[model samples]
Target: MTSTSDLWTIRPAQARDTDILADIYLRVRRTTFLWVDPGKFHSEDFVGQTPGERVFVCEDRNGTIAGFMTLWEPDDFIHMLYILPEFQGRGAGKALLAALPEWPNRRYRLKCLVKNTRAIAFYRSLGFAIIGDGSSPEGDYKDMQLSGN
Candidate 1:
């Protein structure tokens, strides 16, 4: 997708944002993860994400942290996509999800808690298909895919 006006400026995360991101992750851990997350993660546990993962945060015009989403490369896994409850429906989730797939891979996949019907519907609305199921040692979440392939 071509860059929009950057109404929400998107930038590469820095060390400073790490604390903020981790905190947000903690605050909304359940809203996003949905699976059997062990508990609130330590800030340091969020350091690198994964080798090919790309994480981004969105700040409203006022500069408050709104939310964040992550995409893992090659597979373009929808690692996380969440907007603060206060920021929900304002397009933060859509924006962050849209911003992923800079290279536009053929197959994209993500997992959502089996109980989060809302999330499942949202993903379906965006054209993802439930392909399989996955267990994270945490629990089983429905695996979804949208493959340009």
Candidate 2:
């Protein structure tokens, strides 16, 4: 499905968009996950990790891809949502979330690294609450969930 929010256009990931999306994935992770070893994240990791998951990409008014999100349908898990640093704070993440099928009527869950306070706050603003906490190889994390409307 296609969705538009302000100047951002959100749509399903097309085959042609994979390379750019993977690059964004690598770049965002390297920059955002500062506590993790940057070398551990590779562009190909996006391709490998996203199989069987539904993926979507958001583009700016000029048609440049600015971010992407991935969802594991079976469990309603928001596996990843990343926007290019240059395009952040424009509601691309929220647009991507809304583009999900049956959004706001379907529960969602995601793990946010405890150190990423900005992300935690963002999620909280979207109505996600920390339901549990745990540690990952990168650092401690909080398991957050948002109930359906």
Candidate 3:
């Protein structure tokens, strides 16, 4: 597998990418949510929500799907971000984030599992601040937001 920092392109997802994206989503979720119910992966719910948001995919030089993210542009909410385990820490997440269309005076917000310290740290490094906390069927989570500035 290529490093996430290696040459990769970000593009709008297409119907053809459904399976690949699903696989990445499941794999990443299972790995990250071990503290929760692994059997409740909810792969369908994850894939089903893609159509409602702006989905972007990160592809490697070989055209392999490495990761993906979903953004609700209207609300400036980052719905999901998942990178294959092999591709994590390779800058794929950062690249996917960079691909989000920029808007003036728009703050972005997202909820991340509280147990996902690495992801929380990553978001914090990108200037996101913890604003609150919440709970879901999966587990406890922290609300994080990034300033428009």
Q: lDDT: which candidate is best?
A: 2
Cα TM-score per model: 0.78, 0.96, 0.90
Residue pairs clashing in model 3 are: 5-90
Error of 3 at 46 (Å): 2.7
Candidate 1 global TM-score: 0.78
RMSD of each: 3.2, 1.0, 3.6
Range of the 10 consecutive residues with the lowest summed lDDT in candidate 3: 1-10
Model 3 spans with C-alpha error above 4 angstroms: 1-6, 103-105
The best candidate by TM-score is: 2
Higher-ranked by TM-score: 1 or 2: 2
Cα lDDT tens digits, model 2, 1-149, are 89987788999999999999999999999999998999999889999999999999999999999999999999999999999999999889999999987877777999999999999999999889899999988799999998667
Between prediction 2 and prediction 3, the one with superior lDDT is 2
Poorly placed runs, candidate 1 (over 4 Å): 1-7, 30-40, 102-106, 147-149
For residues 19-80, write the lDDT of model 3, one tens digit per residue: 88887888788888888777877667666776679888898889888899899988889999
Clash totals, every prediction:
0, 0, 1
In candidate 1, position 51 carries an lDDT of 40
Task: Score residue 21 of candidate 2 by CA lDDT.
Answer: 92
